[model samples]
Target: MADMPDRTGPVDPPGPLARLLHEALTRLPADRASAGLLLAVSGGPDSLALLLAAAELRAAGRLAQVHVATVDHALRPESAAEAIEVACISNALGLSHTVLKWRRDGPLAGNLPAEARAARYALLAREARRVGAGALLTAHHLDDQTETHLLAKARGAAGAAGAALAAMRPWRDLEPGLVLVRPFLSVRKAALVEAVRGQGIAAVDDPSNRDLRFARARLRAELSCQPDQAQLLQALDDAQAQRACEDAALAERIERLTRVGHLSISPLGEFELGRSEPVDVSILSRAVTAVGGGAYPSPRGALESLVHRVRNESDGTATLGGAQVTWSKTSLHLRREYGRNGPPDLVWPAGASQACFDARFDVEAGAEPIARLVPYGRWGRGPLGHRTLPIGVNEAGAIVAAHPALRWKQGETPPALAVCSRVGWRLCADLAIEARSVLTGRPQNAANRGEPVGKGVADTYIRGQVEAACVARREVARAHFQDG
Candidate 1:
């Protein structure tokens, strides 16, 4: 445990900055008031200001316990010392602090900036989970958002441009439970610097921010000389509003036509073809990605070709994003390509809490080791009477434990297996919620009325699998006792 700071007296007042932070905090989900927050501080001016504002909120009882963490990417020689300095500042504010390190060895895959950003988020997420914090806060502000939009425009990155225009949301789910929050999206960088200076906190400036080799740094330099700052900001705001409307409309169309499960199926006929090509292509891309379990959607060129075939041709087969797409006269069918090499075997060690096999099924173990999990393809057969790709723990080709035991006898018990439908479930749920929002004229995030949509199904399925595993373990114990 890190050393706890003294909670003696009130610190310096944050003045107007405190008010701004409170307003942003109020916009978060209602449940956030109870769920604690984790601040990702880099000892920079922006993050230091965020920490101070959050501390004020904590003092006023507007927020629950607040914790701070600094990541040492280990890329710079002075990063370790800088992390220690952040700890001291956190201590001054009477907040618990943690130092997380990036332990990746060897050179990165050439994209240093992108890799570093990903690594930073991964570290922050792990720390958020460790501290049981529901929300992770960063200090990204309006200037950063503007820079992002301009950079995307310069590079002709339409997708990145749209994302930058949308800017950072008040809250986004980083994972299943952890939400990332950026309260300073509307605040200016100079305002944050002033706030940190008012608190007598000195921040370290990372030299990388000004490096001309990076696109963002070059954009930042150009912005200093650009006279149309207000116009640029206004354009960004308008773009964000338009993007929101487009997203809601697209989500509605997707919900109407797509069904996500073991197979992401959608019916395409005159009704779908009647819509704009962009909408049709977007929905199909999401479907293919969901079914294929790919990290990203297929390229636009491939998706456009597939869309054209689906509209014109009667029957055909195509592969995109590791998914086999087969279309008939009326509908398109997408499923994982089992012929392609699946994920490697998973070792379910004894007493392991849970294991995932091939990223498809959730595997729970019994009291003993149960069995070493292998792909069903190795045995040249499906498990539990289902043709879907099933996983089985085998001993020399004899099946012992199988997930989704669809064909188990009435008197026989088998190790539990449940479809890991998180990806598919989220896809469907997001579309459904967005569609409802568009229909009801409500905000997309507000459509669920406070509760997370689709969480219940995923949670219920996993809980049922865990409970079944417990019963199996108990049954095995009872049988052993009877034999003894």
Candidate 2:
């Protein structure tokens, strides 16, 4: 049996949960694993358990610096108090704590949970960057994964998609530098409850978990009634295995295409397919989302329809997921479609040196303070034509320069701008990096430059592979515990 650390002056050896956390942390890239971590503790049992385990590890010199952040969404009257309680606990444990408040400027109408979640992550990301943390930790457990699978299924996920939704990745990039890590996804909620009890802390039991007002809560209620936990997990395992197979095959295809020069992405963020090249739906979906500036890939049915049109039509243009798709006998082109509204102009704060524009590029305003960043198209045309990218305009509306991605003959030197691909790089990060390197003549270093690293667009496949491996290991561990 693993030794549990005492809460007194002298600490004992780290416990089993701490060991699990160590394992998870070690799985990250060495630099990130050793760097400081920001723990998102909500005072809930799972998060509290994570905090306790991490604190023990830190005290034993098994972990690096740890910071705690409790987000007060201000949805309930008790939320602020709960955040304070978490802060007090963190202080007693000898860790720095920050309470980030989510201030809602307007009334949010649809999907309150989803909205809150987005806000929470944004706040956490801001805090993490400010504190120089490499990664943020969230205590999502096995029960959460099961609930997610059930929710996805209820939303009409089926076939390969259903398989892909079976589980969550242990670690994923929240942005270029900051990663969101779930160390306890494989741990059961019951184990976490026990761990918290062992720590002699009273964890918050959020009424929302049993409120039944939310979809996940309602699903949790149903699952708890006749909890055939083993059967559900077994089904998830099966799905995860299927997802791994799909991802491997997809990765192979992407590698082959890149090797053969059939696939390439330009510095202007255009995804191009060579003439006579076969159209892979998965690859096309990623290109469309990346170029279209959409958060997710285009819907499957609509994407398939677009593919059919691309194959049949000799030369035509179509819009899907905010990206314009133009096909010709020679090649197919996909780029961001700026309609009547065009891209939103970025108003640079007086003293700020950096700002993300269109969620697509990281812009650095040099010595000259940028008054406003307008679409390059607004000032007629640059090297890439009108609206190809953004440009800096002064108060008098004179074009100062183009985006770092483009060249301007009449304008001064552009500010430093680097592409942050709108399309997620989880699936084909390597390919995306290579394509960017080949097209832009830049070194292939995604880590330092804030560029994404991964396969590219085979997210479903890669996610499946990662989740399956994680699930398999946890299952083996569970069986071992039972046998012992």
Candidate 3:
């Protein structure tokens, strides 16, 4: 027999995992050519495979800096040890690694798993920020997607059409400046395990994965006995595609109907509302959430009721998602309900880079710590009305600067403040810059406009005016600091 092909001389060129990862990275919305990525590793086969694939990409100069982090929830006695082992393996691969621990010194409450997952992401996000990574990568694969779909279906959240079975997306914005990417959503667990083994990496098996007490584990066991696995996965894919198309259309309609500012002003009469309740509800829900500055949209049942009330009542105000919704003959208006959802007082110390007052304004302070942000509504009616959602920084309990055009104390200037209806406009600005860069086919640093992307020409024009005022305030702050 011909001397069996020299077993493993140089190993095979980038495997399936590496190729898939390269393709996924190329599709990321943001510019990753010079950016770093933080991988949330669990020392499991899936994460180990991701690390191995990422290492390959880095070595080939197809990727940038790669960092690894293992979050130890500390629920299990073996978890700490597993994290240490993961760190060791990561370091051996010539990657920087950190182990984040979730410290729990009190009794657990409802949904321990859900709480732990939230803490895990928060820790991951903090670490990603500290390391200057633009995105966080997770090892959620095809098996996890199937498990999620089955779980959603069982929970009655999947709807009659099984729309919830669409599963997780490849990318999501976890927060501003931090994106969560799941590159292996389409890859299988078996493939991941094989990839890890190919790299000579030993992965740890968590007992929790097999514990029948967990819903996912129970579902996995149930799925193992099913013979229509391929068919189920294909159906899920089709459902996901249909859901994507519907969501895209809804977003486009919202973009046209909704306006972002102190209020999510919309002209409902312009659209044919009688036959499009679902679309109308979606638009109103998004607008309420955007204007209310809430972390999440209102519950579906409550939102549908609100839509019915808005459409039926010709002239009245109702509260939904902490926003006051008012409708008249031709238009609908939604604004923050100050009594129910007003922002807390913010302390802006001297020399602070930036501070957000409510989710509506981005306030930047100069080198001096001499301002406190107070709600404009708190000061009663002044030259600027309460409708502005104005925020003014006070020095020694006296108003110095109020946003949407107001500056007191002629000689004493205040810190710079940029107003936006929601913090999401910053994300939009980043995307806009990224799109421009992609369209121009040039590597360009994202521009920092420090202003909101308003919904219409009027809103845009007002933002421009506020931005100019902020620039003047910055100059005043600089000059004041210099004189002192």
Most lDDT-accurate candidate:
2
| lDDT, candidate 2, 86-176, per-residue tens | 9888888888999998877798889998899998997887787666676788999888989998787777775546565666667766765
**In model 3, how large is the Cα lDDT of residue 188?**
63
Candidate topping TM-score? 2
Model 2 clash number: 11
What is the per-residue lDDT of model 1 for residues 1-484, given as tens digits with 9 covering 90 to 100?
2343443445445445555555444444332322557899999999988887787766665566679999899989999999999998888777899998887767678778989888898778767656667668898876797887776676565554353355555455554345677766666687788767655677888999999998888888988787557677766665666555555666556655432311232211001222222327776776667556566667778989888988888778887876677776755666566664454666663344455454444445544444566655564555311433445555554556655534545776565554333344334332223232222222322211233211232223221122122223323323332212
lDDT of 1: 0.59
Lowest-sum lDDT 10-residue window in model 3 = 448-457
After superposing candidate 3, which stretches have Cα over 4 Å from the reference?
Answer: 1-13, 30-34, 160-162, 255-279, 339-484
Model 1 ranges off by over 4 Å: 1-16, 29-34, 158-167, 254-279, 343-419, 425-484
TM-score of 3: 0.70
- Model 3 residue 311 CA deviation in Å: 3.4
Worst 10 residues of 2 by lDDT: 451-460
Output candidate 3 Cα RMSD.
Answer: 13.9
**TM-score of candidate 2 versus the correct structure, residues matched by position:** 0.83
lDDT for each candidate structure: 0.59, 0.69, 0.60
Question: For residue 290, what is the lDDT in candidate 2?
Answer: 66
Using all chains and alpha carbons, the TM-scores for the candidates as numbered come to 0.71, 0.83, 0.70
